[model samples]
Target: MTVAEGVRPEVDARSLSDADVLAIRADFPILADEGLVYLDTGATSQKPRAVLDAERQYLEHENAAVHRGAHRLAAEATERFEDARATVAGFIGADEDEVCWTGNATGALNTIAYAIGNASAGRGGREADRFRLGPGDEIVTTELEHHANLIPWQELAARTGATLRFVPIDDSGALRMAEAARIIGPATRIVAFSHVSNVLGGVLPVDELVALARDAGALTVLDACQSVPHLPFDVRALGVDFAAFSGHKMLGPTGIGALYGRRELLNALPPFLHGGSMITTVTMERAEYLPAPQRFEAGTQPVAQAVGLAAAVRYLEGIGMARVAAHEAQLGARLAKGIAAIDGVRLLGPAPGEPRIGLASFVVEGVHAHDVGQFLDDRGIAVRVGHHCTQPLHRRLGITASTRASAGVYTTRQEIDLLLDGVRDAVGFFGVRA
Candidate 1:
């Protein structure tokens, strides 16, 4: 795990070696194909056999309704389900009661927004008053946000008569902190933003934003969808009131995700959905709900998926997160340098030699992003195109869409070279000149 003599300063001192990466690739069955070069981990990761086996094994042997039946199967299912919650909670450095399972990151974020909206509408009793928002109240976010992070707040603002403000990013897609101080004032009720730019692949200044929110007495919500999988993440360390992340992006199942909140805050917040499993006592006239995490989870839980996600975290823990971050850092540097050297290619987010994760987005002059994506696809190289769920960021960058190449733990340096070569070939194939 020692740092090489000439390694980039942005890269962590401890990184996985070439042999480590090659060995890791064997865990993913999809990577065994000779022609396939996957660089779309930003969208969804390729699951290892362990994750797949965990889910399948659960479905085969322990399939039962969690928190419902009185049989042995139900007991087993509930035990595994809650154990998965504990695993996820430990992974994020949160109390077990603090983590709430949701459909995905989008659902997790919407749960918060909707809960606040419900609180504003006089739900959850007097304890929920703290979450209430009105006309004068402001919810601050950033210009560079995925639709999942941006739209829910927009809906919350619209429903509650609260104003939504955003901190603008500079021309290079960096957050403008000077402007942020002005925007996040006493009237700001919630300060929601991404921990890392999904489009830019650059980490955001979370500590500074949290400080601003703390000074303003505002609740901080983090979109940890991009950061949690790539970086060594801890909700307690980040000092965010709440955070949301998806399992699919972290090498687990698609339908499950988590929302981490402080225990008191979650208890105070109103529930987003009402159903059988989340309640304590129910009469014909009135019904009471459980506290915190259980209050948030309703109906059928994702039992097998939870087991799978737990396995995914365990797999990641086996390979230290610091080493994972360092590996991605090296890949990011290579992407930046190679893309920068290419004629007519504009690298988004951090420039070459700057700090970023193992992902890069760019625009090629005289070529549509879709064309570039298709060109890469033709060469059996997978990448992402379009605004990448960040239309506002794309508009700010003065483009409709761009191409993105991302990596995961199973990705190798050789695959990164393949993508670079494909992009270069695409520029020539599209008749774009220096």
Candidate 2:
């Protein structure tokens, strides 16, 4: 369905009214299930009918291996595939040649790490010298990074004999900017960080980090998994050298994600996965690969998934990202305030009035996170439990896990309220008192 089909055309798309949001919710078939309050959008979003239909249409009518065949179907498939690339590029404010499709955000991050490792091993030759790392060189990231961002760097450091460092976070899960300044110095070869904390929900200062990386002559890699789908993001505006985000978290299918890099950087970096569909020419002894994206995309591409992601991007654009940010801000504030008022509940990330995305992960004293999650699920309120793939962040908080209630565009105030009520009941039921 068109974005304007169910929603009121008279209303400005920049401001999504309650009626407009409800109308938008009608596009998701899963939400039609009665009493189902899905508050775990941070984990993965419910797919819109538009995204589902887009993938289905491609699979049923236009399925063919992209850039490999000479027939009409193959030609049409290749056109659709490249068009999807263009659409994704536009969404992230990147050039068409800068975006590369991957299996997921983890794979995307690994792609950069492995490419750097290859450079250190002298795979890309003199042009890839920019990516080389050595004993004295440091790869700087933050303690708040998801494992997907952190572990890859760790592996890279090990493989290249480089040191891996991190900007520390305080007890409240906020990044220590002063420490970050001190830690990220001339030795840093790369600065990788999350755009938003999946655990804490606070937005990181991207421009500030970019400036630090620039001064250090280091490349900046952004984990935009949490920010791109919800915020009005521009990779060029943020000035990051590379970024990675997933389709599943942004209202599209799983097994599809993207890595965006500056065209020059991507072209200079060596290919991570080597196989068919990415090479320009092959000799019995040696092979030469294509440019940035093609060199990275080896084997069969996820044609249907890419089309679905493009559809998801268009759907978000229809509602306007500014409006999405505003709506989620309101929900974040409500969640923070409500959780703060509940005895024995400790809210993570920003304070009640502080800026954050529309997600709250909190610890309820004397209750295990899994117990809380079960209670919420019993009441038809779904939330994320455990470390949210941020074990280091959780360890810093002195907790093993926390229950996270995250919102989406389709989420209503009532849904947040229901989540809050569920948490309250969970506390009471578990006999947890402050």
Pairs of residues clashing in candidate 2: none
User: Candidate 2's residue-wise lDDT over 3-79, tens digit each?
Assistant: 63444323443546788678878889999987899999999999999999999999999999999999999999999
Off by over 4 Å in 2: 4-15
Number of the top-ranking candidate, with TM-score as the measure: 2
lDDT of 1 by residue, 1-434 (tens): 21211223244548788887877777888999988999999999999888998999999999999988899999999999999999999989999999999999999999999999999999989999999999999999999999999999999999999999999999999999999999999999999999989989999999999999999999999999988898899998999999999999998999999999999999999899998789999999988999989999998888899999998887777776787888999999999999999998999999888999999999999789999999999999999999999999999999999999999877888989999999898888888987
Every model's TM-score:
0.97, 0.98
Where is model 1 more than 4 Å wrong at Cα?
Answer: 1-13
**Backbone clash total, candidate 2:** 0
